[model samples]
Target: MPRYKLTIEYDGTPYAGWQRQAGLPSVQGVVETAIARFCSAEVTITTAGRTDAGVHASAQTVHVDLERDWPADKVRDALNAHLSQAGEAVSVLTAERVAQDFDARFSALRRHYLYRILNRRSPAALDARRVWWVPRPLDAEKMHEAAQRLIGYHDFTTFRATQCQAKSPLRSLDVLDVTRHGEMIEIRASARSFLHNQIRSFAGSLAEVGFGRWTADDLQAALEARDRARCGMVAPPYGLYLIGVDYA
Candidate 1:
């Protein structure tokens, strides 16, 4: 068997999430279907990270094993052709052969996420499904200050989703930066792994700070409290994007 690594990008607005459900559409399901169409085999792919419903990905990584090795470009173009024919908002950005020992998920070194907020009284004219619209003025500086408190290892129970299956809440966050670009407020988070909904949780809480409802000290206190009930809010999934993944 030969293994190939693929980089994928998708508009996550139409699927239930990255994982395949029996009847629901998913990124994984569509890609697998496209692969079967290309090679007529029931193939499975290992994903580096799985985004939730409505969460987009710009550089998602996955690897699949095929019984026979095909040209990498053919695999990319063929699957993309099938996906396009099906009207799926997904694309195979690139595909290449990799060592058999490479495991997409386990071999990941970092994962990056970006959340966008359309900040202004005027609503999103074109990017309605890709950004969160906030009429209230947001102080990006406050959000950034609050975000810094979340760096390093901590028990992120306040931000972790109740339904999250992660065994522990302890994780190290490498970067959490808040910035603004004209009418957009961008929040970027990078980590080895995140508790489910953690970034959204942070965004919601940080929004409070940005809106002047909370301060940096308040955000820090919420972190120390480690209580889910104390969590401010979970930002909408549409505003979230899996920006990239890194591997050694």
Candidate 2:
């Protein structure tokens, strides 16, 4: 068997999510179906992140195994062509042959996510599907100050979804920053792995700080209590993006 690594980018507005669902269209199902068409065989594709619905991916990575060898470029082109024909909301940016041992999910070292908030009274028109439109101004500096309290290894039960399947809530957050560029307020978070809905929950809570509804000490207490009910609201899925993944 031969293994191939694919770099993928997708506008996730129309799919259920990255994982394959029985009745719902998904990024993984679309890409796997395209690969099967190109290889003329059954193929299973595994991704580095299982992003939720309405969340975009700028540089998502996946690995697939085929029964026979095919040129990397041909694999990329054929998959893209099939995806276009299927009217799926994904594109294969590139594909390359790799060692058989290269597992996309297990080999990942770090994953970075960005959450975007459109700060204005009017709703977005051009990039509405890619951003969250908040009708009020957000104090990015205050959000940043509160986010600093969340860095380092800690139990993040307060920020995780109740249905999360992670064995543990202990994760070392390598980076957490809030910044503003023009009318967009962006939150960047990086870690080895994230619990289900962790980023969205964090964003929802931090937004309160930006709006003066919460304070830095409130965030500290939430983390200290390790209680889910202590955290702020969970932001909508549209604002989240899997920006990058690093491998060792």
Candidate 3:
């Protein structure tokens, strides 16, 4: 058996989510079906991160085991062919053979996420689906300052989804940065792993500060409250993206 590592990217707008469902479309379902069509065997894939519905990924990592060893390029090209023919929006960017000891989920050391906000008086035309459009003028500087309060180890129950299955709310957030370029505001977050809807939750809360509805100290108080009700409006999934995953 050969274990193959595959880096994939997808639009994620048309699919239900990363996980397979009985009747709904999903990134995992389409990828697995494409692989089965390519090799005539069922293969299960383990991904580094499971993105939610309408969430995109530029470099989502996954590993799949095959009964016969095939050339890595063949795997990538063949999977893409099947996926494209079916009109799927997913793409396998790269594939390579890896040691059997590697596990995509557990071996991951860091996960990076990005949130895009279109902050301007005029509405977004080209990036309506790719960004959160906020017509009101935002204070990007204040949003950045508020984001700084979320860095470091802390109990993140305030930002976690009610349905999050993570056993603990404690996580060490390595980075949470906010920056603006012209009319766009980008929020980048990095950590070993994230709770369900955590980044989206952060984006919404941060936007409050940008709207002058919340202050840096108020954001800090929300974190200290550790109550889900204290969390700001959870951002939509369309603007959230799984940007990258790191491994040693």
Clashes of each: 0, 0, 0
TM-score between candidate 3 and the true structure: 0.98
Alpha-carbon RMSD to native, per candidate: 0.7, 0.8, 0.8
Model 3 lDDT-worst window of ten? 121-130
Worst 10 residues of 2 by lDDT: 35-44
Candidate closer to the true structure by TM-score (higher is better), 1 or 2:
1
Worst 10 residues of 1 by lDDT: 239-248
The alpha-carbon lDDT assigned to residue 65 of candidate 3 equals 97
TM-score, ranked from best to worst:
1, 3, 2
lDDT per residue (tens digit) for residues 89-156 in model 3: 99999999999989999999999999999988888789877898888888988998889999999999
| lDDT by residue (tens digit), candidate 1, 173-246 | 99999999999999999999999999999999999999999989999999999999999989999999998889
Write down the RMSD of candidate 3 (Cα, Å): 0.8
Which pairs of residues have clashing backbones in candidate 3? none
Better of 2 and 3 by lDDT: 3
Residue 206 in model 2: lDDT: 94
